[model samples]
Target: MTMKIVKTLFLKAPPEHVWKFLTEADQLALWFHRGAADLKEGGDWTLVTNTYGKEGEKMCWGKVLEMKKPERLVHTFTHNHLKGVETTCTWTLEAVKGGTILTLVHDGWEKYEDDPFGMAANHDSGWDEHFGRLRRVAS
Candidate 1:
């Protein structure tokens, strides 16, 4: 089975507003980890954290695959926690009646010989926590 973590969140803000939180460094720092540089397609995608493990250290680093403002983003993701294995994260934004629907699909784990549920569950919880903060500020 392919191990993956998918989450759908409804934010009380338009796609334009929600997109900023997903791409811009300043806006990302307010909800998620600190962006190491401007997020652009084909550029380095680095997110640093002060609380995860080390202080002011990169939590994840990879290359940005695709970035369509206010619509979608795809990136290669890897961190120390993944034991050097890389994955892909795709964020899709949909404009709704009064807000945006942000869906995150973190996949590419079809051969992780360990307990998939445990692994996916951990990341799933982490995403929920991040989304909680995103909701507060985006609204």
Candidate 2:
């Protein structure tokens, strides 16, 4: 089974504006997490999430595999809970009449086999919540 998590949402902003929220450290922290990144191909990035109380902060690190300003980005993602397991995340943005359509694809879970910890589901819900915040920030 090829496991993947996909989500799409329309934001009330142009692709350029939305791109900043995805790439800039301060802007990302407002909607997603506290972290910084170079945002270029092969650049390293990190995000520290404080949303899970008692579990403290969880750090996710990745390297940018591809980047096209205001259009698309592909990166390798991994976190502590996954014990160095790596996956790919792609984000594509399209301009529309009212806003930009953002599509996110997080794939490569088949590498984890049975996924006894359900990390994919946790990330699915996490993206949903973060996207909601992203919408508000972009509005």
Residue 3 error for model 1, in Å?
2.4
- Lowest lDDT sum, 10 consecutive residues, model 2, at 49-58
How do all models score by TM-score? 0.91, 0.89
Q: Model 1: per-residue lDDT, tens digit, 1-139? A: 6778889998889999998888888889998888987799889888988685676788888888999888999998888877777789999999999999999999976544465577678878888999899989998
Give the winner by TM-score: 1
* Predicted candidate 2 versus true structure: per-residue lDDT over 48-91, tens digit per residue: 76566723354888999999998999999888777778999999
**Candidate lDDT (C-alpha), each:** 0.86, 0.84
- List clashing residue pairs in candidate 2: none
RMSD of 2: 2.6
Cα misplacement distance, residue 13 of candidate 2 (Å):
0.4
